[model samples]
Target: MTTTVVTHQPGIIAQSQVVVQVTERDWSTSLFGCFEDIGSCLCGWLCYPCFACQVATNAGEHCITPCCVPGAMIALRLKVRARLNIQGSLCNDCLVDTFCGPCSACQMHREINNSSNGHLQ
Candidate 1:
């Protein structure tokens, strides 16, 4: 298993060590789990650009990137999957984006929100 050691300097001269285990796991929410979060679902349904921007921002990415670049959501999904060790592929990302872009964005947003306390990594 791969593990990461994170160090924190609490004081000017004192430091502490924290170990974080990196485990592979599936996504917290399915692609069709948009309705699970009413807020996310409504936001995604009513205003897709705003929802996409929120997802991108939550993932520590530029909010405007998804707007300016095509397929940016797919790239964000891939990055999040890689960071969290989620099993998926570029083809899957493409399909999700193509078929249910809004729902996919909402799902990714919820997953990221649930996984890291609203932080990306």
Candidate 2:
């Protein structure tokens, strides 16, 4: 766990302490369980225990690094401050409604097609 204090760099003083918290995930759990959990996924904003997270959060920005699928979701759970206006591309395996993001039906169709064409692993 880590905390950070940021000031205006000038004589103006503005400081906050960020606390990192950890939670557990179950890979076998259903999709709905992950996204709809308000406490863990929607309100957890101290997942990244580094200065970069503090900087980004202070600037009101979300990280856009290419992380693994599950890892990305986990990070989202950790760094989210409030509900996002997310639009596009939910995970293909899980059928969670990612706001304005990818539709669950379309994802299911793609999966069916891939499996039928022997393209799915």
Candidate 3:
């Protein structure tokens, strides 16, 4: 009897295959570095709710997501961290959002602004 194997459907990796991995990265700016971006800080301090909307928009999310969707801010944080390869967990995102919400928003805004891609545009 003869048996044949198909390697196309699900794709298979050979035993000798090599995988490359890059070290996990942290956010470009510190979580508490609100002053690092003066414009974002002013926005966060002056009009918080609107600032949140802007942050959402910056993260390529709907402008109203933070207001309409519960836990949207935390979700946005996770998405941003994941998209940028930033090292973080959902629990940490939730905690940071709950405690230092304004600072977090500023950080996200700065991150998006500093990014070169058109992920937000």
Best by TM-score: 3
TM-scores of the candidates are 0.78, 0.18, 0.79
Tens-place lDDT digits, model 1, residues 20-82: 977778888888886689999999989999989999999999989899998899999898898
Give stretches of model 2 more than 4 Å off: 1-26, 34-38, 44-121
Q: lDDT of each prediction vs. the true structure?
A: 0.88, 0.32, 0.84
Q: Any idea how many clashes model 2 has?
A: 1
Alpha-carbon runs more than 4 Å astray in model 3: 1-18, 117-121
Kindly provide the TM-score of model 3 when superposed on the true structure, using C-alpha atoms: 0.79
Using lDDT as the measure, what is the rank order of every candidate, best first?
1, 3, 2
TM-score for model 2? 0.18
Worst 10 residues of 2 by lDDT: 100-109
Q: State the lDDT at 18 in candidate 2.
A: 97
Q: By descending TM-score, how would the candidates be arranged?
A: 3, 1, 2
